[model samples]
Target: MSNKAGSFLRNLGQFSPLDPRSRTLRLYPLKFSRPKISHSNWNLRNLLLNDFDNGIRTSIRYLFQDPFILKSGDGSLQRKGISIATFLRVDRHHCPRRLSFDSKHSLVSAPPFDDGLKKVNVNPEVSGGAGLSKEINPPPISYRKLSQECNSLSDVLDIFSNAPTFPSSTYFSAMWTIAKRMSEDQKRFEKQLMFGHPAFSQLCDQMMKETRIMYYDHLLFSLYAMVKLGVPQNTLVVQTSLRMVQERINECDERCLSVLSILLKEMDKCKNVDVLKAGLRILVHQQVWKIESIFTLQTVMKCIGKDTSIALKKKLEMKALKELDRFSLLNSQHMFEALAAMNHRSVALLNECSKKVIDNIHGCPFKILVSILRSCRELQYYNLDLCKGIADYVATTFDIWNLKQILLFLISFENLRFRPTDLMDLLMKKVVEKPESLNMRNIIFILYVYSSLNHTDKCQHKEFLEVMSSALTGCLHHISSENLLKAMYSFCIMNYFPLAPLNQLLQKEIINKLLTSGDTEKNVSRLHILDVCLKLDKVAYQHAIDLQLPLPPPSLSLSHSKVAQVLSSLLGGEEYFARNVQLPNNYHIDFEIRMDANRSQAFLFSEADVTSTNLRRVAVLCVPRSLYCLDLSHPRGFLAMKMRHLDVMGFHVILVKNWLMEKLKMEDASMFLKTKIYSVEAHPTTDVNLHNTY
Candidate 1:
């Protein structure tokens, strides 16, 4: 060995383990003002000299300097090159553990001979007043490593605070991965900390000020995760991500649109949301044909919604039809609902869907049937084979369903104007078997449906329903006025009137509730109608004596519907045709025309004209879309009853439907109205043999 190296090796051995002065030796610890170690001077602290290796000698001091870490806000935690360095502490005692290391996998070397700390070390009194000026280059900020090691939100803050610029896409993904691994509770807590804690906000601002190299999916997913994590969209991070989405919308695809669909509403409330939504729509309009997934297409349709331009809706509808065959039996409900949200559906598409539904009817869920049924009405797409299959399935599966299932099935069917005779029989028995499952409203609906079906004394339905009606008398105190009036109306229509129920409903308090109801005009008209029904039964007339139901409501103003306006302009004027004319028996007529002798001249007729025999009255009622049966040509009992009532009241009935109004010009609408009125005069649709039936 060289003489100098040999001398240094011999000198290293001079500090022997058995030295007598080791018992009470003093030491100094290294300290720094901040993590800026490159130019920071190393401060010192005095500590006890006592440290031993399993009762061995303590002549030589050993220390470890952990890595000088610089964590990033949103950087990946899985980084390489973090090494701990073992070094020496001159003195220390009764202090918290401090660990630091270098990024280069090397230990902190001892002070060189030229340094002042080396000379004063031999005599501690001289170094006690001196500080070390050694320039320690701080470890490189390996944020990727910090992100990979992140176990908490605090770690994320460290990375964010130290990052020199907005994190790149990969770094953000790594950070988000750390968050994803957290438990629900941890995520919730961390989310709260991010938005509620100002320090975190300030720390994240620097790194999330702008999206750096984030693509469409990255931006959307980050925004989605942050919102789902409880970070409000108003935050700078979320806003920046949203802006990036607009800037990169052309780069987005179906996956991106699907994610955006979920955040559409939430993001709508954020700042500058209009530009974002419009931009998204433009992007969607451009990329819609590229979407093939049925669910994604459905989401895209709903995201576009009903209020968008006609061209967009038509594009979406065409796309939906192309993807219709892609739907499975369970997901068929989504397809139907998507089409229903729109004002139009292709008849051929609906027919094909109907066939497909019936073919797969055996596997369809009960709730799915309900949605399909309801959507059929909304789209006015009806097929008897499909209806029959659904009815048979529901009737066969009756025992497994709850009351809600049965009622919803019936409600949808009722709207579609299909009387599920088989299902109704099964449902009636189910209700009789479980009366507790049937609430007051259920009973009232049953009564109304049974009455409309003209089932009085023909079968046990009349008796069962009468019993059900009597059972609701006990609930009169809490029963809603709407329900009570409905029950009474059903009984009135069925030619059966219960004195006790009628008396109880007419009580001052009940009458007040009915009069003060939110829908007062309808209620008052109903009250007058009930009074008229009571006059048919001598005994029931007594209950109407002191009943101060309001006078029959005035004929309603003409609606803004193009059909109504066209009908009025062709007839004469709004004043010439009484709109929303109500009969004494509560039959609703959309427009009432009083015809003179020879049916040449027409006069306006009001509710008071119900007793007029001098004029041949014509009732123009708009059969609501719901009143149309699945056949789309026939009316259900709800509507059929009105027709029967109008026929019995001695008025020829005419029906109006506002279909294809968008494409119908004023002249076509006027002709449509003329044909509708004249066709009824020549031959009624609801009552083909009206004069013979009456």
Candidate 2:
């Protein structure tokens, strides 16, 4: 059985050396009359007839047309160890002296240089290599090796040409590797490399011009590399660069020039915004032009509209009217529009232009005024008249939201000297007149404005809450309960900032609104409530401890739900304050006044005696005090704990009654309190012993 198994395995190995599907068979050993390995060139016919077996000859003919190797001049077979030139030199010497060479490989062959002849001085000192020996002629360098280095350079350029759209770190890595190899002595090619060459300015310009929209990042990276490689920013190079870019700007693809023009202008000005804006004006041809050009006219008018200066206003009107006269343009609508919007020296220009255009029945001058207003709005150049112009446009268009945003913008602007109350009134009228159109964000914004402008000592101002709630409930149709709740929370927090009428009652009502409107989801309402709780808890604790404010009235306990919810969230969590915190011996405490009249309680635990057994606790009682005093004289009192009351009164109260043994239990605590005889306001040393109790 073992012999049979071995034979079966050996048979499987028999045909494994050659692929069965291949028609060609190997002709390993040829039978020839001359030594089979002799150095000679023989035809296929001769080899087939005299050397190969019949089956091998047929396979060899099918696989290849010419399968023989040439012999050396020494009549020895050329193999791996023979140098190529030696084989060539020796093989030529073996050919018959009389035979004419007709082979293609030998057609271009030249006689080898003579060793006896002294070389010419043309290349006697090759600059890069060591001096050559006079005794021996150096072998000609290989084309094959030079070709390989050329192939590597080609590969580097190919990689650069096909760079991925969004370059990854790996792409940069590959580039750095290729750059290292090609730029072995990189400084040598700094003048020739495309990225380092002045000629590359044209390439960049061509790319940006060819595409309608440039990937600004790619252009920036390329330009950054060029600048880093010491591309000089002189008059000639800069002009050349600008000329290339100007060609693109001429083609009207402004986006391509967006980053490019910014670079060129700011590069000279060293990142100055003013210089960049000036450069943009030049790039867009926003300068003096033939008075016939409407674009130039419009741009000049727009710039003048955006400027607030009274002096500059007169100057701009003079410039525009002069340009209008240059074309002898009689009362064109464009000229009339520009005249109407000018702040100085344009009333006559306006009357003339408006009369002609009106005679021609173009009464829609407000359209032009609105366009001017919109442009100046973003530039923040609006005044009362401009605001009125915008309001008039709003009245016509009924764009209440746009009007609100514009009003909000005006309200938020820092440098505006005009009164905004009138504008606010206008917006409120719009809101009241069209309730369905107003969204909650607008109403909130209005309220935010009210809060910003009206924070003063006047307590009679209606609570913003009622206004906000009414607007929210009545005007806003699509508001979700959850967002409404969160908005309320945010509003309450904002309210805390201004010293407004705040009380436990108001806070309780706010909390009720929050929880009632919030989603029950842990994320939705719970997190928001917790946020409010953390804020309020700090306020509550501070008021209780620092201001010595009384515990908030139990009637003002709408916040209880929120507090309970937060407590439930914090259960078993390390985030809560623990009773066992290793507190300092002389711990300092501070309190800050927050929302309404609430304050914050803060504990400052410093260096501690970790091994100490007794802990000190200070508890405060009462509301922010209208009266207070400090007592340093205390001989009889044990100075049990520092205590403060609502009147800012400090007391060195002696906790003379240690934990009553029965007080540890609830029933005992109740009985002890009921039995102890106490005064309404007892001094610290006034020891009232409970031994006289019934």
Q: How much lDDT does candidate 1 score?
A: 0.57
Q: Best-fitting candidate, measured by lDDT?
A: 1
Q: Deviation in angstroms for 178 in model 2?
A: 37
Tens-digit lDDT track for model 1 on 214-270? Answer: 234655765665555555544445555655555455555667778787777555453
Point to the candidate with the largest TM-score.
Answer: 1
lDDT of 2 by residue, 457-560 (tens): 23323344444455565633575444444444444433332212222213444445434454444223333333433343334333211121222212111222
Cα miss at 653, model 2 (Å)?
49
TM-score of 2: 0.26
In order, the Cα lDDT scores of the candidates are 0.57, 0.33
Per-model TM values vs. the true structure = 0.58, 0.26
What ranges in model 1 sit over 4 Å off?
1-207, 265-271, 323-332, 342-344, 444-457, 537-541, 553-694
